[model samples]
Target: MAFQCQRDCYMKEFVTTVVSCCPAELKHEVNGKKETLKGFNVKLQDTILFPEGGGQPDDHGLIADVPVIRVTRQGPEAIHFVASPLAVGQEVQVKVNWERRFDHMQQHSGQHLLTALADTMFGFKTTSWDLGRQRSVIELDTPCMKPAQLQGLEEAVNEKIRAHVPVTVQLLSIDDPAVEKVRSRGLPEDHAGPIRIIDIEGIDANMCCGTHVSNLSHLQVIKLLGIEKGKKNKTNLIFLAGNRVLKYAEKSYSTERAMVSILKTGPDEHVEAVDKLQKSVKLLQKTNLSLLRDMAVLIAKNFENNPQKGNFFSLHKKEGDNEFMNIIANEINTEETLVFLTVGEDKGPGLFLLAGPSRSVAEMGPWVLKMLKGKGAGKNGRFQGKANSLAQRAEVEVFLQQHCKHQTSEEE
Candidate 1:
C-alpha cells in the first residue's frame, strides 16, 4: 500500500480521520546516539508523510498540530508516533515538513541517477546504499574506484539531471510481466500490494518505495566527495546532492578560513606547514632528554662528595621520570648509602624508588608502598612503581631512619 506522499511527492497537506491512538515507546537513534521517545502510535485513514522504509528515513511533521516524532510501516499501515493522543474517528490535518521531504526526494532521486549511470558507464553495480543526514553513500561491488572513473561517473549523472528527464511511478500487479524486467532486491514478506516501479525515462527502471522528485532537474546538482573502503571487497562512494552540496561548500569554506589563521599560511600551503611543525617538535624532545640526563649525573656527584653527611639520601623532583630517578641510583653505590627518590607533586600522585642494602630494601619496600596507597615489588636493592598518594612522606622517612638505626646497633 503506497502512502499519498509516494503517489504525489509534492503533496504537503492532507485531511484524514484518526483510526486509532495507543501509547507507544519508540527506541531509535539520532546522530549515532540512542534516544527513547514516549508517545502515541496513531493510525490514520491515510497519510501525506512517508514511513521509514526502502533505505529512506521516516518523515517528521505534525498530526493535528501535535509533533509527530516518527512514522513506521507495520504491514501495510503507516503508524505515526505523535506527542499527544487524538480521539478515534476525529478529523485532523496532517502536514508534511516540505523542506525536509523535498530534500529526501532530491537525494533519493539523485542516488537512482548515480546508480544507473555507474551500471552502464563504469560497469560498477551498487550493492547497497545509505542516505545520511549530511551526505549519502553507495557501495559498489568493486574494491575501489579510481579518480578518472569517479570523475566520469559524476559527469554522466549530472548530464542526465541537465537533460530534465521525467521520473514517473507505476504500480504493477505482482503477476505482471514487466515486474520481472525491473531491477529489484525482492519485496518484504508482509508486502500485500502491487509492485512499485520507478522509471527514469530511457535511463533505468528500479523498484523502490521511497519518495522522489518528479523530474531529474529537481536534483539541482550533485558533488562526489570521494571513496572509502567497504566491507570485504567493496568500495563506498560518498556524495552530496541538491541542497546538501551547498551546505557542504559553506562549511568547507569556514574550516579553510580558520585553518589559514591558525597555520599562518594559505590553504594551498597548510599541509606542508603542518608537516614541518611536526618534525620540529620531534627534534626538541630529543634535545630535552639529553639535557635531563646531564642534570641527573651532576646531582649524584654532589651526594657522593658529602659522604660524612649521612648514609641515607632522599630527593624529589616534580618533573622527573623513571629514567631520571634510575640515573641517580646507578651513580651512587646503594650498597653503601640508602637512596630514596620520588617524582611529581610532594602531596599528590607520582612514582617512587628505593635502592639500598638488599635486606633493608626488601624488608621495608612493600609496607612503604602500601602506606602511600600503592603496590610494587623489590628485587635486589631496588623498589619502584606508581604511588597514588605522597602525603605520608614524613612518616615513611621516620620509619626508614629507625630501621637504619636498628641495623647500626646490631652491627655494633
Candidate 2:
C-alpha cells in the first residue's frame, strides 16, 4: 500500500516534499558486528532516485544531506533508507548519484538497442539479461553466433547511437491497441494497470518499467566483449557501455605495460619470448628429476652395506623431499628392518618417512607425526608424512632406537 501510494502520487518526478519519516522495520549488519543501524525510512512526495526493481539496481544519493544507503518499493511507496532520521512533512533536496544512474541508463538502453537489432536481423531473441557493475550480458535463445555476425551487430547498434534516435516512454492502458504492437513476454498475471512502454524510434518498442536515457546519443558507445555458451543451448553476449568501455581499455593498456616491463620484451615479441622461456624451464625440470633419482640410488646403497645397527636402519638427508624419501624407502625395506629416513635441514621442517614390516610401520607412523607436530597416513609396509618441527627429529631417532631395543629384549 505504501509503494502504491508513492508510485501513484508522485508518478515519475525527480524531487518532492517528504511525506513521512519513521524507523525502518528491519535491521542490517555493518562491518563484523550486528548493530541496530539508525534507519530513517523517509517517503518523499516524488523523487528521482529509482527504487530497486525490474532487474536494475536502486539509485543511491543524499536526501537533505543525509546519506541514502538504499531504496525499496513497499506497496505504492518508495522507501528511502537514510543515515539518520529526517523530520516528517519537511521539504528535502534529493540528489541522484548521476554517474551511477547514467551508467545504468547507458547499459540498459544499449541492451535494448542490441536486443532489438539481433531479433530483427538475426532472429536471436534475448532470453534474459543481467546488468552487472562492470559489464552487462544478454542471453540469446540461439546457441551461437558467428564472429562476422557479432561484428555486424555491434556496428548496427553503434550506428543507431550515432543516428541520435529518440527513446520515448509512454504509459498506456493494458487494453490499448498500441500495446498490441509492443513486444514483450507479457505482463504479470496479477497486473491490472497502465503498461509502460519504451520506444527507440523505429528500431524497437517494448514493454518495460526500468529507466533509460532520453536519446541514443547519451550511450556514447557500445562495445561487445565476446560471447560464451550459456544455459540450455543459449549464447551469452558480453558488452560494456559508455564509461565502462573506457575504463576497460585503460585497465587492459596498463596491464600490457606491466607485462612488457616484467618480460623485458617488445609487445610484438612478448609471446615468442614467453614460449621459448617456458620450453627451457620444462627441459631443466626433466634434467633435475633424473639427477634426483640418481642421488636417491646412491644414498640408498651407502646405507645398505653399513651392517645392521640394532633393529632399525635410519638415515637423515639434509635436503630431501617426499619423492626422494619414497625412493630410499623402496630401496632399503628388507629383512623386517625398520627404515626411518628424514629429508630436510634446520632451515625448515622436512619430510619424515618410516617404512618396514606392516606392524612397525603402522606403529611408528602415527607416533613420529604426532611427536613432530605433523600428519600423514600409509598402508601395507610404507608410511610417509611431513614434520613441521624437525628440531624434534633427533628425539624421534632416539625413540626409534629405544623401541628397537625393547623389541630385541622381548625376542631374546
User: For all candidates, what are the clash counts?
Assistant: 0, 12
For model 1, give the RMSD to the true fold: 4.3
Each prediction's Cα lDDT score?
0.90, 0.81
- Please give, for residues 292-396, the per-residue lDDT of candidate 1 as tens digits: 888889899988888574778888888788898999999987897788888889899999999999988988899889888876788989998888998897788
Cα-based lDDT at residue 74, candidate 2: 67
Q: State the lDDT at 320 in candidate 1.
A: 80
Ten-residue stretch with the least lDDT total in model 1 = 307-316
Best by lDDT: 1
Assess candidate 2 and give its lDDT.
Answer: 0.81
Model 1 residue 109 lDDT? 92
